[model samples]
Target chain A: MSSKTANPVMRSAAWRISLWATLAFACGTMVVFAFLHRFVASDIRQRTDAWLTGEVEVLGDVAEHTPKDALYDRVVSEVAELASNEVPNRLRSEGHSNDLVFFLQTDAQGALTLWVGAGRGEAYLDAIRRRPFKPDEPQDLPVAGSDAPYRVVALHIDDGSIIYLGLSEHDELRVLRNLRFRFFTWWLLLVMLGFVIVFYTTRRMLSHVREITEAASRIGHTELDKRVPVSARNDEVAHLARTLNHMLDRIENSVRQLHTMTDALAHDLRSPLTAIRGKLEMSLSAAAHGEQAEPIVAAIDELDRLTEFLNTSLDVAEGKADALRLSKSELDLEELLRGMADLYEPSMHEKNLRVRLTARGPVRMLADAALMHRMISNLFDNELKHLPAGCTVEFVLETAQEQAKLTVQDDGPGFSQEILPHLFERRVKGKQSSGHGLGLAFVDAVVRAHGGSVAASNRKDGGARLELVMPRGLAAENAEPRPVIIAIAGSGKP
Target chain B: MRLLLVEDELEIQTLLRNSLQEAGYEVDVAGDARHAEQLAMESAHDILIVDLGLPDRDGISLILSLREMGVSAPVLILSARRSVDDRVKGLEQGGDDYLTKPFAMAELLARLRNLLKRNTPATGEPTRLHVQDLELDLLRREATRSGQTLQLTPQEFVLLEYLCRNAGRVVTRSMILDKVWGMRIQPDTNVVDVHIYRLRGKVDGKGQPPLIRTLRGVGYVLKDR
Candidate 1:
């Protein structure tokens, strides 16, 4: 394979896989060969040794087939020329490579002493000189430093004498050498095959892991909504992908929440700062250096706005974003709305706008009284601020089927189209140009916290309309709310 | 009255010096808590104004450090953070009074007067004090203008009390909010103005003389004739 191209056979996974397979195959084959060599080959060698020993015992029998001297003349005539001299040139050793040395003995009277193989030396004759024949059993010798294993078998004849056989380990040694040579060649081929398979699998697995790792790093810098892709199969990789995506979803939510908080902070702070600078500059220009009542009025206004923004922002951040704790104290929704109307009556008169408030029956509601009061007040403030002057502002509340509906309508125009899109987006509403835009934002937040809905739209009669729908499941019956003049800060709803 | 100021920001120091000198006080400025302590101990001053977040050592403990060394001059803490917990903690740590930063010079002066009055040794009763035609009869608990009695409401009486106590000095709304109400009022309403406008009618209603002068961007003060 070319190095430039991806080839499993040349990779580490391929190499390891092939190597393991080859080892497994070679071990199994070697075990089978080991048993076969122990049983079949050893049997053949034993029988050959016995037959040779029987033949050597029959050397005494050569006297029956022919005269001893004649047999010797025939044997020498047939084999002596080939065996007596060393042949100089040949393809293989003409000598018996591992042929046994055969000895003939008959009551120590046979003429044939011992005929070793063509390559045999004097060691066989010296061994026979000490003992002419062996007993009727095979004998094993510890051939030190020899790689091949063999055994020797001795046979007893009817003449009360014995013939012995010597078997060398050359045949078994040759078989093992051939087997080893074959093993390496096949091992190399199997290793290549295994490497191809392992490399393909491990590479795919690593790519999936790498993809998830990269995804984790990207999420910190990029959009949190981005997720890691999962594998087709439902496995460990797929599980990781699902988990990573879930984590990203949570991170996205938290990031969104943080953005909202930052906007809230900017809006809340801008109010006080604006007031401070305005009052301070106004006084400086007026050249009133001491005990100016106007500064006190301006400063008081700034301080109040500053405190309100801070408290509301704190509550929202704590997730108690509900302005004013839920004053579970039973409240008369009608009375609260009436009091709100009375407070706005003077402004209504000045603006030449008539306010008609319709209150029905002691409809009590359980809610954060002050927060609800603020919510309605905010709706009223919106109409006063967003609409042009000299328009009729209507306030009405009704309880039907345990649901209370509080609606405010004005003959002036509703919110501008551009303002509608971001009305509830904290500081996104232009508080500087449009007085603390958080008033409606605060209204939205508070109403939602109390499990109510607030909707604003153009009234059918060419005016702005706001409605707050609240369920009365939480309120206790017959509890009354006291009438008090809620302070409507000139800044916003409350 | 000569005063010592321990503040880090130059703008704030300038604001303090300008307002204090305008109010006729000899002022000395210190940049750190250690220097403030040294200044307070070295010189006898009518009042001390300290700002937290000093470069060396915390300013809260500096007040305690001064008290430990027998410098009983009232130490007023002015910090940028107005958290309730921090304000309570400051008072608990031997600070005579606390005000958040970005405060008007009027507010700072008012607080300084309050602290000085609270800590000022009663060598003798201040039975008679005059601001132009206005006179407060401290022993009899009455106020008069050119020997004519003036009718004042409880709040009006209290307001006049603060103005008489620090005649010729400016007071800010924040000081009024803290001292008069004991509760921080929101900065959106004309509640303070309404009260001041009403009180003006009672104290200077006879047309004898205008005892309360309005210092725009600052606070109300009673000037001595």
Candidate 2:
């Protein structure tokens, strides 16, 4: 699961989508809550404004018709009645009970004559006196030591007297605060839900894309017959799998055709070549000695060369068809090369070429022993065929990190610049080369099939150098041996 | 020695018959697997040379059937299917040896002679091998020439033994590599020549007739001449 989430694309996509979705959801919730907050708040303020205005009008009537004493009595009785009725309601609900509407009367002067609410009105009266009030608009009186403000209203009649009415908006403010708190809580929940939904959906969709990527990574020549598994759903990913499967089918068909044609050519061409060579050889043996038999022997030699050329062509074709079957084993590198050097010692001496093998000790590697021998032998063959007399051929073996490296070098005319780049390619032979050019190419194929690599270049000082590097171990360790047997022409047994 | 040769191609059959006859062996030819089986069953031929490709059946099955019929003569299978698996399969089915198509006649004759030598009676046969004054004791794994014991490495001993067995006949480098070294692929180098040169130095010595003579580009022949 960690590996799945570690994919950079999927991780970033999931995070980006979740973050944007949560932000968008939070913004939308804020907008809706802000609108509701304003609507509820305004309605509460309007009701309080209407009730305060009516109290001021009733006080105005008392101040005009009665004397100052009667107005005072009316104000006092009204304050007491409101306090008694508000007590029960405040006790009934645990809300703001600071709704004590205050009434005050002034006798021909803008002075404080009455006070109400929780605190004394001396400070309230001073705040009201200091501020100017418009006759048509209600005034907001700030209570000195509280966080809530009050709505103040005033009324006057023809009695040369003034009346002021004040209503504390603490209850309405508390109601609006509660509404905001509820809205914020719900908005937080919605944002969390948005994040989860977005992340999950994005991750699920991208996982399907990863399946296609993994399938593509496994496609190669050896696995041309394999196809990406398709899901049952008729989705984009399934369609891609189907398309890739169709492509694989086409590739496998072509590979099969190439293999069949190669086998046929091996049979059709080699059989007749065999017959011709046999007859020529018989004639050479039966012919009279000296000049007459020379031509027959020469013809037979040419036929042998032709047969070798055909076999090389078949090897190249087989390489292309992926038919080079390998039987792997744990082989001692020192012994294998020693055998090769021993095999080539005679030819090396014929050219007066000094062959030196430099190896520390036995280097064991998991490889196909026969193929490895042939690969090295082909290299030596190249050295013998191209290098001049008195030149030296060196075989160096060592362990570098986890790989076994073998370098074959010869102090000879290095590869021409024209053929250096295409050295390992089939038929990429040098001008002095008499071979069919499949020697090095076959070597390259054998090395690659063993999961190793081969390279050719010119040495700095002089000489052509070819290097073969193979891993020292296999992924399956020294797993069970395959039952496939490789029968060489005269090899007795393993 | 009488030989039975089975081949579908007329030219190859005719050529092999003439070559074997000239080599001083009586040869009988068969154009197909059926005729070859009939001849092999009726006559006591010293050797059988059968081709894998036949009109009636595969030569491998033919050889297998011959063995099943209690014909114990050494069989050499010839075929165009030179893949290791095919050759191994042919040998696994009771073939004494296998030679691929487009082979050298000399190599074929040498292999046939080797097979025939093995099939001959071993009674009264000395445990030692000799080519003129040179002698190799098979039981003791030692070699001596002119009453002087020569120090020989294991590889050199094997090479000398092969040359002694095929004395007076040419043995190609490939044939020696195959039989002595047990190698199927021939190296581009003249490894056989090098070993033979080493053996000649020890065996021929000073004031000795050269026992092993190079046959130019063909091979080496060991003879007291």
Candidate 3:
């Protein structure tokens, strides 16, 4: 895609929606995982404490049954060793087998009297002595030599000597770590899958919207009959498309009604005008060179003027309403200007006015050739009617930034100050002018209808200047050219 | 000359019929397409003037039926529909010329005459055209008057040639614009008059009898006298 083209991913609502949904899902899953981890860790610690408490109570009972003699130590030590063996060897190697559990016996004075397993439990002795032991209760002890803490439980006998047992928390930590690792991996996969599903689903739904937009944009004024495509699915986009189609139907109907009304108006009005004009011409011919001929001629001219006014008024109104029917074709402005100048030279000469045409090259554009010709002619007619004798009218044609600019300037008395504001409006003319004042209005309408602009201003040096800028590219190339019928010389009867 | 006029409006029909008769043509009138088709099938006409807005059927359909029946007379369409598309449509569908309504009788007559003249086949292309002392060498694209070569621009020469071809007959401003300049729309200005004025100055210089005469509110006619 071009850099100037709109980036659909960034602009589409789908992108934002999917991103936010995935974030919310991830956060929700993380909270659930945290709660689950805490629950499992506490449950594992409770099981370990139960096993430590039962083992410590059994050791205290074995000591209470033994006599206070040398054999007592041996018997108690052996029983402790037997009980330690039931801890379930969690280490993978034999070298650290005994390191997982330690046993210690202390007197009523808190002096360590007996110790078994893992180097006499020297590293954990001070930690165990620092806390007062509650009978059959397990407590966590941070041993000096191990990163994992120990869970220690104590038991009291009738002689007041305490029996203590400690179990390493390394195995518990390993189980929790394994559970967390598995959950995190699964969580990551699910979040990615969720993001993909949401993004694609939303994008798929909105693609129809994009298609509708494109189809709607393609419909132009001339092709009012065309409509945006409506999809079959009963969804919001489909509803929107149907509504647009209905609107188009109403618009096309109204335009057709306008055309029918205007056509009828033309027929109704022009019929009587034709009759009156024809009758006057007949009478003028019958009374040729007589006293009655002059007024008949004058009446005929006035009728013709009235007809001109009617035509211009209708055209101006249609143009203003953006309803003017246009048959567009490629035209060269330079060539058209030159032809018009040659045609008008004699009349300008009669008024002792000079016309100069300046052009860089052929400025080609797509427009209604007939309308453009009449528009330019109206400009020349304005100059002819309003310019004083000996004033020069200059016409300049040039292409600027893909626009065809045509300027008509005359070194004459500029427009009257009062009418300057409303120059292009209908029926706004100079006091000395003798026109129906629809010329400039028609010009403005034509320019606007063609998607162009027109401006009127007085030059700083004292002259009237009219500038028209028409876009060179109009996408009406599909408009068909009217067929020309050449009269065959010998086809009809002589 | 014989002419057939088909118009729906009674007033226009009567006015056109009277004017055409006064212009020295044997005129037949019809108020609708059905009557026009009947009249056209009955007798041969030298020319036909048809109005598009008829009562029973469109005038275009009538013209088509007439042509299909081998009625080879030239047709001139007269209608109140003044759009360029309407004019082109009329001509494309068997019309020799198209004239909008509220038209001048002079313009109608000139068009009729031109159509009639066009129907007759010429023997061959002429190398030169002459009217009184003015001569146009077509091959060389040159014009001379009274043994003096006229310095005329290319456009002026073409305009003069169109006028000379219809010498002694009136040709309107629109006709000149169509034939010489090939412009389909008539400008609302006196461009033709000015061009003719300049052409007259060149053709009939100082101390020369003028051959062109202007019929006010109508057109110009170059006299052969």
- Winner by DockQ: 3
lDDT of 2 by residue, A63-145 (tens): 56555564667655565445435421123365445444566555557766655555676777777778887653577889787
Which pairs clash in the backbone of model 3? none
Q: Which one wins by DockQ: 2 or 3?
A: 3
* RMSD of each candidate relative to the true structure: 21.0, 8.1, 8.1
lDDT of 3 at A357: 82
Residue B59 CA error for candidate 1 (Å)?
A: 2.3
Better structure of 1 and 3 per DockQ = 3
Q: Can you tell me the CAPRI class of model 2?
A: acceptable
**For candidate 3, lDDT tens digit of each residue in B117-190?**
88887578789999999999998999999888999988899988988988998787777887887665555566
Best by TM-score: 3
Model 3: per-residue lDDT, tens digit, A62-138?
Answer: 88888878887788778777776666424454456467778888888878878877775556779887778787778
Candidate 2 backbone collisions, by pair: none
Q: Is the docking of candidate 1 incorrect, acceptable, medium or high quality?
A: incorrect
TM-score of chain A of each: 0.42, 0.63, 0.66
Give model 1's clash tally.
Answer: 20
Error of 1 at A329 (Å): 17
iRMS values in order, in angstroms?
Answer: 7.4, 2.8, 2.2
